[model samples]
Target: MRSFFMPFAIYVLGLAVFAQGTSEFMLSGLVPDVADDLHISIPAAGWLTSAYAVGMVLGAPLVAMLSIRWPRRRALLIFLLTFLLAHVLGAMTSSFEVLLGTRIVAALANAGFLAVGLAAASAMVGSQAKGRATSVLLSGVTLACIAGVPLGAVLSEFWGWRSAFWAVAIVSVPAVIAILCAVPASAVDPNAPTARHELRALRTPRLAVTLLLGALVNGATFCTFTYLAPLVTDVAALSTNWVPVALALFGIGSFVGVTIGGRFADTKPLQLLTIGAIALLGGWLLFALTAANPITALALVFVQGTLSFAVGSTLIAQALYAATDAPTLAGGFATAAFNVGAAVGPVLGGIAIDAGLGYRSPLLVSAALVALALVSYSVARNAAHRSNHSRGRSPESF
Candidate 1:
């Protein structure tokens, strides 16, 4: 097996993830600037974010299935280059419609990059180390939240939103260069499963249940998280400066959780998932109860972030195991599931808020979703166990 230091290829993939993630997350901070510059309403500007999520939901499985026969390294490079070009077009576009289109294109490229990157990372190491490799690849998103997202926000604040897009394009240049140097041109699998096979894997009962569990877990987190700013301001009663501090704390917790989760992902995935969900459920309940206390609310925010990411890597590992026959496509499906949840979460939370349920109401909604996720996982795990027992085989973990 290759030593950890030899994974220059995975590091390059991480760079690609960071570059794409910066583009995805920076938009939230740049919404006001984008709206003002384009003379669009705030809600219209917000739709740009929605467009990116929609693209991701559609693009992940689409790209994975389309590129099933391509060399993983080549697919990674292609996606990175497309992402670079999309950001350049985004920076240059003046029309809101044009900008929205660019975001969708960029998001497609981002989805392709992530799906192929996971397959590449898993292939690089022994099966036992696949979980660790996944964590390293996914660390890019958390690291972006900690640094790249804030840097983009600052760039948008000082120069302009277009400058932030330009910055993403510029950073992508190094990522593309790194991948070119580090990622080898491996041979494509001529006997790779057809699109039909990939689709069939999705139809498997266990895989379908796991995907739904992923979606629910993600939705539970975002239900409250999508409205975090308002919750902090109106309920937590913190000043604007503290909002950034709170966000930083959440990022820090995520970084910690992913690292810890990676250590156990291979051997204790089911246990970790259950514990993480319980922690998250408790964390949200605490958050709802303590929103009036600024310090406690901020502390719970960090806890929630930790719990949110802790289960995430393990869930991806679970999905990969469940769909071993179609791992790459499974990764894409998992990405789509999470995005679907992310898209729906904010809408549900928004409805509650519009009904005058208050900012903390989102936390209640989040907790309910967490309960549903737990129930879903339990059902899936038990079904797998029963089927395995009937076949005279040991049951697999959830």
Candidate 2:
């Protein structure tokens, strides 16, 4: 019974993540519709994406600290409900200001749910399976990219952008019910680390570097991903009808990447990160150069997406592992780190475009960020080696 129920509970959590991740990413496809509907400039509309990310960055640690002592099921349910409410409000609001407010509220709810959900999923599995568990949760996000994001674009194209919000709200209902029925109260640790201990975990150099790596990798991803619609149609010279296809292909690659990362990350984290980052940088560079060719651009989009998520998911598992001493807040730290990248990436991409760098600028921006990520990894590897040497440990022990 425990075995049967555990996977069901984890997938339910993933379902909730699917709903939130849909909301988080669907905006990339709806940017023009949102701008036209709200009578805002395109860049201004793009800021909505940044706003959600910013809220996540602030909300993750805040919600984690506040719910440190609460029952895991209770925290998850409350956040899930708040997310539903925010979407409903967003769907009902025509005023951009109100919509922005809704996005922030929704993001707070998303951040809380993700932090709690990751902790809960990891706790349910054995130590050896933590990477697999993390992948299961993140798979929802990849699946969202595959189906929800493209469907949101289709819905927006046909029924209007608000329908996308309504769809997310509707999808979240089943997840709420599942959580209530399937999640056990014991998911929460009664003697969870104090908030101080959780914060102290951040001071570890290795953990800090891991978090930075997550930020850089995710930043590179969103920098390109957030502007994919424009890149497909404007730069690649594809029809608007190709936007969803491009997005779906990227999603497909992400799903594949996450699966591969999850399979090997437990035993070969450093190698996965190292190779994935290099390949991702090369993919981004190739994308920038060939973005004018529709076919090549589309193909590279898929390749870059795979490499991006492969590295991104591994970084997430690494962050959680490095912060093992602060089990309760481990997810929060990872959440905050990735969203920091999410927030900054698009903003920088937008700035580049605004400065007349062209639609391909985001691809170049992504490449640069990945390059920096590679350098950071080298620094981290050397530092790990020096520390391990002093302790008479193998470098691979890192």
Estimate every model's Cα lDDT from 0 to 1: 0.84, 0.88
lDDT of 2 by residue, 121-159 (tens): 887785656677788889999999899988998899999
Q: How does candidate 1 score on lDDT?
A: 0.84
Q: Candidate 2: which pairs clash?
A: none
List TM-scores for all candidates, in order.
0.96, 0.91
Clashes of 2: 0
Steric overlap count per candidate = 0, 0
lDDT of 1 by residue, 1-398 (tens): 43545288888888778888788888889999999999999999998998999999999999988888888878988888999998898899889998999899899989988888887787777577667777887788888888999999989889999999999999889988888888888886678777788778767887788778778878877887788888888998888878888888888887887777777887788778878888888888888888989989888888888888778777776777777778779889988888888888888899999999999999989988888988888887888899888888877544
Q: Give the lowest summed-lDDT range of ten residues in model 1.
A: 1-10
Against the true structure, candidate 2 reaches a TM-score of 0.91
- Model 1's TM-score against the true structure: 0.96
